[model samples]
Target: MKATEMRSDCPISSSLDIFGDKWSLLIVRDLMLHKSRTYGDFTKSAEKIATNILANRLQLLEDNGIIIKLPYPGNKVKGLYRLSPKGVDLIPALIEIALWGGRNISNTYDGSPFLKEVKKSKTKFLKKVMDDLLEEETNIG
Candidate 1:
């Protein structure tokens, strides 16, 4: 989809033309929240996104400047996904959504204790996520 073909001049609609679908944003959510960096990691998500859908969404995100694929330093044949600066900008939105859900959804988050802290301190949580991305070793003990 192109800006020229958008339904209207509404900014939200225009943005949706790129990532309006649940799968696209869910991919971003995974990247933001779970440190998922590879195709398999995304496939193993609880949502269990299908292989073909994941591939198409990944390509779509890359074309939109939301993410970039890089060759894994150790595995020549495998690729790792990383967020671009533009993608990093989505962190706050994710946090806000999470916090809202945390407040409204009962017995929410899958028993992750950190979520308690996140609901208390969104800034700190967002910082940690951003920092973790910067320190992407993809290989650690």
Candidate 2:
């Protein structure tokens, strides 16, 4: 979304403007767990996002520089999606939200190793996540 497209001057509003939709963040969450994913992978998500909406959200993310679309090796018709630096920056917020849910919601994530690591030491977990992403980025390049 462009600056003029924002609903207001508030930072939160601007962020919501870009990714307020229900599916965008889920898409980001999937990207966080996997360095790269395919369109088919997204379609297979438990959320069952429709193909059309998936295409639109993917386009919006790419347009906003939150994600990058790379050609799938040996498959001209397929593409791989990966988080951009801007997208990776959302990890902390995602982690906080996950923690909030774990505290207030059900035990859905109680068994998740990622949340366990985060609960153990958020700083260390975040550092490791960033380092891993950087390593993947370097290897990709």
Candidate 3:
């Protein structure tokens, strides 16, 4: 469904309704940045999302058309989830959030490389991510 058709009353509320959950965004981040595709990969995240929560978020993301599951070529019972175009669109927002956190939040691990890339050329960073996503999707397919 189109974004226009998704909600009419309050855009923010509608968006939040779709992506308000913390796990959902983290799943998206993993898919976007780490190219994580399986349940095992998500469970291995630094945040250590619970198994049941991860399952629910994956289902929700699939239901929302933000991700699609493709079967593992050699094994029909196994499959992998990858971002759809709608999901890939969240990259800019993620970049902004990462940059903001890197700037204001104090953390031991320096995110300077990512921050510098984002600051120097947002367009380039976005393009690179888009390319990477496309490449990943192609490989999966």
* Cα lDDT of model 1 by residue, 44-123, tens digit: 88888999999999998998898878886789877778887788888787677777777798967745766676776888
lDDT of 2 at 15: 93
- By lDDT, rank the candidates, best first: 2, 3, 1
Q: Show where candidate 2 strays beyond 4 Å.
A: 1-4
Pairs in steric clash, model 3: none
Task: Write one digit per residue (lDDT tens) for candidate 3, span 27-51.
Answer: 8888887654777888988999999
TM-score of each: 0.83, 0.91, 0.84
After superposing all C-alphas onto the true structure, candidate 1 shows an RMSD in angstroms of 3.4
Best by TM-score: 2
Instruction: Please report the TM-score between candidate 1 and the true structure.
Output: 0.83
Segments of candidate 3 deviating more than 4 angstroms: 1-8
Candidate ordering by TM-score (highest first): 2, 3, 1
Q: Which stretches of candidate 1 lie over 4 Å from their true place?
A: 1-5, 137-141
Can you give the lDDT of residue 1 in candidate 1? 32
Taken over the whole model, the C-alpha lDDT of each candidate is 0.78, 0.88, 0.80
Candidate scoring better on lDDT of 2 and 3: 2
